[model samples]
Target: MASERAAAAGVLRRPRLVIFDFDGVIADSETIALEELAAEMTARGAETSYEQARALFLGMSTARHMAYISEKSGRPCAPDFPDVWHGRLFSRYSTELVAVTGVHRTLNLLDRLGIDYCIASGGSVERIRFALDCLGLASRFEGRAFSAEMVARGKPAPDLFLHAAAARSTSPHECLVVEDAPSGVMAAVAAEMPCAAFLGGSHLDPIRTRHRETLIQAGATACVGDHAELQVMIEAR
Candidate 1:
């Protein structure tokens, strides 16, 4: 496991491949999605708040999130819930989504440094592609985006990250994962890859310190305040 002390020391090995998480790490879309989920639950008579929704569902898979909603509301989610929810979410994403602050600069840095990078997100492939397209990053990540749907298990498990590494033909030790959630940090650790916990997402603005602590405890090798800090970390020897 990665130690917080080591992470705080600000020393990290430069990696050949950088694996980025999509929603909160690359695209500034978590706040929109969480707010929408809270509103949707409230309209369904569950009375959920944005904070509550974020705490409960931030890193969960779609099926797991629906199951959680059903358990919390004491009613099963409609069978078509995923489809309907995604449609609504994508509609909103088209108008409101933007890339995370400093993400483009960070990617440009990676390009100049000659590091290979790809997206390995918990979101569906379709969602990932749509978001990249919306952010005008589709061409940059072409043929390099991976989704959890392709693996047997999602975050908190090593499967998806490992699958991504194998597909990219990169060794786990040669990969660095950039994530904004504890589950993703854990997944990276379990995959034996170093992870930088990103705290720049708007959804984390109100709880950045707490989330940073949580992610460090979850085995992140470092905590980055934003993509600028991330670039510094990546540039470190």
Candidate 2:
């Protein structure tokens, strides 16, 4: 295995693969997702911020989130929550879900460096691919992209990222996960992989400090603001 520096310097490394969370890490799907979700909840008189929505749904499968909410609220989530939420999200992001500010640049750098990577998202495969396509990242990933929908469980359970690592033919310790939600950080940690939390639109502050700590406690080596820090961490490794 080449050292981390070697890998970042464009040399092949045994830990060649990086698994990314799509909604908040790569594409700005979280913003779009929360926007639509908030609006839906608002129409139902349950308006909440992205932070609230994220707190409620991040790292959980959309279907599972709805179910949890239904169980907790003791009221059925709209029978149409899945299709409506999914449809609203996709419609709002019909052509706007883009890679984060530094994501494309980092991806280009990784591509130039010959580092292999994949998307391991909590989103369904169809939703993940839809956003990736909007950002023109679909073809770039091709067969490397995977979703929680492929696994028996989602984040905080390790199934999704574990599936991704298996597909990439890498060991958990050899992989680095870039995520934004607590559930994702937990997922990576549960898989025995290093992870970094990205805090962007989640607007978590006082809680973000605690959130970062929780991530570290759960298994993330660090928490950062964006992919730029991630690039630096990978290079420094």
- The backbone clash count of each candidate, in order, is 0, 0
lDDT of 2 by residue, 129-172 (tens): 78878888888889988988899988889998989989988888
CA lDDT of each prediction against the hidden true structure = 0.85, 0.74
Q: Go through the candidates in order and give the C-alpha RMSD of each one to the true structure.
A: 2.7, 4.9
Weakest ten-residue segment in model 2 by summed lDDT: 4-13
Q: Per-residue lDDT of 1-237 in model 1, one digit per residue for the tens?
A: 225434663656899999999989899999888887787777665778999988877766777767777887899887776676678789998999999999999999999999999988888888888888889999999989998889899887999889988888999999999999888989999999988888889989889888888988999888778888888778775
Instruction: Assess candidate 1 and give its lDDT.
Output: 0.85
Per-model TM-score versus the true fold: 0.92, 0.83
Best by TM-score: 1
**Candidate number with greatest lDDT:** 1
After superposition, which runs of candidate 2 have C-alpha atoms over 4 Å from their true positions? 1-14, 41-49, 73-79, 200-211
Per-residue lDDT of 80 in model 1? 73
